[model samples]
Target: MDIKKEWIHFIENSTEQEQEALQVFLNSLKMKRERKSLTHIASLLQLKTNLVEDKMLEMEMPNSPLLDNSIGIVHGGLTATLLDTAMGTMASLVPGNKRGAVTVELKVDFLTPGTGEKFICRAEVVHNGRQLVRMEGKVRNEKGVLIASATGTFFKLAD
Candidate 1:
């Protein structure tokens, strides 16, 4: 069967929890399709960019099974992705003749297991230079425990 037909057949036989997960994925895709202003990955991940200003960015994402690992906690890569995205946003928004920026390198330290109902990432530019920006970010769970920390370097894109 084709993709759509296969999806229908699979979802029809899925458990309630599986159906919910599929629905969330579908909604993520729908959000990306409906909003051209948001990045596809951000939309796909259902992350909300709460703040984006010069030298700082803050974002949040729901803690659900969709993003969890086999061991029942948030995946390390997802946590790193959140930190990277936040740092990149802050780096790109640096003041004084800045342009878009792309990540040159990212180093993430997983401090503790990511748990809780909601996760937040906060990033700030540690040093802003003519062509390179250095940023640091922290990820915390809903109860305010640090889950991970990251530092990233970004190179400014041309005008």
Candidate 2:
């Protein structure tokens, strides 16, 4: 397909808001390409895994306009995504784990509007069963205000 042609036509007819949306789309693609070796979702969210300690993980992401919704706040879905990532990482990175895990179920509770320069997400492994893992996660603003809390269940991969 002629992506250049479609882009030219879009550029000619797009409004200011549409252009902004296009910018965000392009940035997401760029991030996905750059972080392909790691994780596309992490790149899209610009998440930094700042800590990986025993049965826990800590990460951070900026509250960018690209991640904002119509109200100029971080979208709830993105918040959930970060929590999921944190919990999943905790499950996968546990010591002597021969295989990773996939989330089987997730539950999120949004506590407040997500507004801040950045977000801090932390996850702890609540239980590590032979075939399933349970995790708890919390997302907070830079000011340490809780934004959302979550629980996740992951199914461990068979070795």
Candidate 3:
């Protein structure tokens, strides 16, 4: 079946809450797609989210022409965006009444130039509190070599 048909079928079988969540995700995807022209390269690179969890998550993208720098390696800003997105997502997993969090600080260390078919970023929460969250992020090539690492602090917003 085509993707649209498959999506329709899935939505038809989903519960009300699942459908609502799916709608939210789809709306977010649509907004990202529509606002591409207004977004920075790094923001566009991080817009794609592939994994989600309460305290951890991973995102990946295949090496493509759009992601390459003059030397054919993933750009440094793209790597930094991946790290920041991962850490921010981890912070969002903090338990609460679902108040939002904003990144207050982020620091990234580039271990090596990333030149691979695929890039993966993993983020985990190290500490969470009522008002603050700390997270660590790592980027790896398909071969599991660490390409970059980062730490972030996020502030929970009042609901």
TM-score: which candidate is best?
1
Of 1 and 2, the candidate ahead on TM-score is 1
Candidate 2 lDDT (Cα, whole model)? 0.86
How much does candidate 2 score in TM-score? 0.82
Writing each residue's lDDT as its tens digit, candidate 1 over 7-95 gives 98998899987887887788888888888427767865778876666667788988766888999999999999999888887777777
TM-score of each: 0.92, 0.82, 0.68
Off by over 4 Å in 2: 5-28, 35-37
Per-model lDDT: 0.85, 0.86, 0.76
Q: Is candidate 2 or candidate 3 better by TM-score?
A: 2
Range of the 10 consecutive residues with the lowest summed lDDT in candidate 2: 35-44
For residues 19-130, could you state the per-residue lDDT of candidate 2 as single tens digits?
Answer: 8767766776787887642776687677888566788889898876678889888899999999999899888876545689899999999999999999999999999988
Poorly placed runs, candidate 1 (over 4 Å): 97-99
Which 10-residue span in candidate 1 carries the lowest summed lDDT?
36-45
Clashes of 2: 0
Model 2: per-residue Cα lDDT at residue 82? 93
